[model samples]
Target: MRPNVRLELIRKLMQQHNNPSFMKKIIVAILFVLLIVGGGVAYYLYNKGPLDVISSHAVEISAVNLYNSFLSDSAAAGKKYAGKVLEVSGLTEDVSVNQNQETIILLRTSVEGAHINCTLEDKTKVNANKGLIHIKGICSGIGDGDPDLGLPADVYLTRCFVINK
Candidate 1:
């Protein structure tokens, strides 16, 4: 209505808004939430990067739901993820390390006849002492895998090991 009344109203509003403590707490809370969400998004995006485009490289992408890929799929996976350090989690079964010590790791995936290998950086001994373990390794091109060489080697597992869960 009147100018003086409007000025009083403005002053009241300013006083209510000048809550530094509350403002600080709200800012902190907002920042905390943003940091957490940002970190999660960064992690998720990092895990699902250019390599994991779900084009053959990703044996089991969290996004899509399809199974029973062909044996050659590894080749595609390799091509997509070549020279890149990628992580693929799968059940370890029939794992073995050969004399060459390439560390042949076997992973079980949802796709039938479709398997993914997490090639480790170093060779491991196929000792009975080592129990079933989750593995992480470098992604190598589907070349003359260990298995192609012979028993165990034919599996083409290189730089293998048991993943610590």
Candidate 2:
């Protein structure tokens, strides 16, 4: 019985050594799958544009409600609204272009509270002097200020489109 067990162990070891190509094939297969998956992900990301709030269903919110929510608990608000499409309707406080040539629309809730700073793709679409407007944008996140330029902007929204002016 002991001799048979030893013989079986030796046979298994010999089989494993002889089947080195099995491990190689498995490794090659895994690497090939990873490469294909990575390429597919890259292609999808490259072609896919930002979320269009105009065509899709978005959360409708007033600028004041959005501001108050963020002001109360920024982390919770950010988790809820960040990267999501939103339709924000409010009075336009100011409109200006940043260094990147993006149109920025500031919608202030009050004098002291936070404001929703929406960045639009086209500056020509929105008039800088407009009053109340409805903007559809992707909420980026809340901001206290710009440390580099010393600008104090509150909530930041990007990829914005003016639904109504």
Candidate 3:
């Protein structure tokens, strides 16, 4: 078409695109959607605890194997087991409560005095006996080893629940 006709068409398109009412409505809609989504995410994260965020399809392994994997290569073990639930079975070395009233069970492994520190979910429900126990928990990482005794490092598991006594 002619230059004048093209210029007029462009002007009309610009006027429609820059309409104040339409822009206001678009901005309001975007803001409303953002608010709703943000609120939903915030509420979900607030209600769900850290341990609950772990993957449901966990890798089941013995406590000794878990410890050995970490001892062999901590970075590789962390990549494989971190943020995943683990079902570990071993002898219960010690059972104690932390300051927050959380039950912590130390599961003995092949390494002497080195134990997997499993923090149970229910504080009042754990009645640990000195025997073999099956536990399901979220493996966080490896714990520091006993410096004085030269014991190997321990695997740290959180939100643990007794699977079998």
Candidate 4:
């Protein structure tokens, strides 16, 4: 039994020596793959930002675009993007107060008559009696809005804060 075990260990070492190229190739491939993945992760961390827990009562209209795109195509988005901090600039319209009595500032895309439906989750929907305001908030994204509402309501963030410019 001892002899057999020694032989087996020797066989393994011989097999490994005979396939040094194969092992080298595997190591190189793994290293290349790791570099690519690590670079991607580093880039994401540097550019996209930290993966901190995000909770906001208000967000911006850019969330509308993100949500609408997701709603227009649900399979394309994930929960990671919903109701996060945002910076958006657009023409404010269709100011509606939610059942919670929150103000949602509907945004019209800079394009002629291109409108996106949006709602505030915990925001105070100040009457946009003032037209064409820029918005920022904490938005919750739901599936796209129904056809009757038109456009999309992919994300709904309550107003944590807003800067009307």
The top-ranked prediction according to lDDT is 3
What is the TM-score of candidate 3?
0.66
Candidate 2 per-residue lDDT over residues 14-130, each given as its tens digit: 787668797788789999999999999999999998665679777999998998888789899999999998999988888888898888898978545457889886667567665
Please identify which of the two predictions, 1 or 2, would achieve the higher lDDT against the true structure: 2
lDDT of 1 by residue, 59-135 (tens): 32210111122244755655555554434544554455456555556555454333455445455454434343444
RMSD, every candidate, angstroms: 11.3, 9.4, 7.3, 13.0
The deviation in Å at residue 106 for candidate 3 is: 1.1
- Worst 10-residue stretch by lDDT in candidate 1? 60-69
Give me candidate 4's TM-score against the actual structure.
0.42
Q: Could you estimate the TM-score for every candidate?
A: 0.37, 0.64, 0.66, 0.42
Q: Whole-model lDDT, candidate 3?
A: 0.84
Better of 2 and 3 by TM-score: 3
Across residues 56-163, which tens digit of lDDT does each residue of candidate 3 receive?
A: 656779888999888889999999998788888888899988999898999988888788999988766666688888888888899776679786777899888787
lDDT of each: 0.48, 0.83, 0.84, 0.57
Sort the predicted structures by lDDT, highest score first: 3, 2, 4, 1
lDDT of 3 at 8: 100
* Better model by lDDT: candidate 1 vs candidate 3: 3
Candidate number that wins on TM-score, 2 or 4: 2
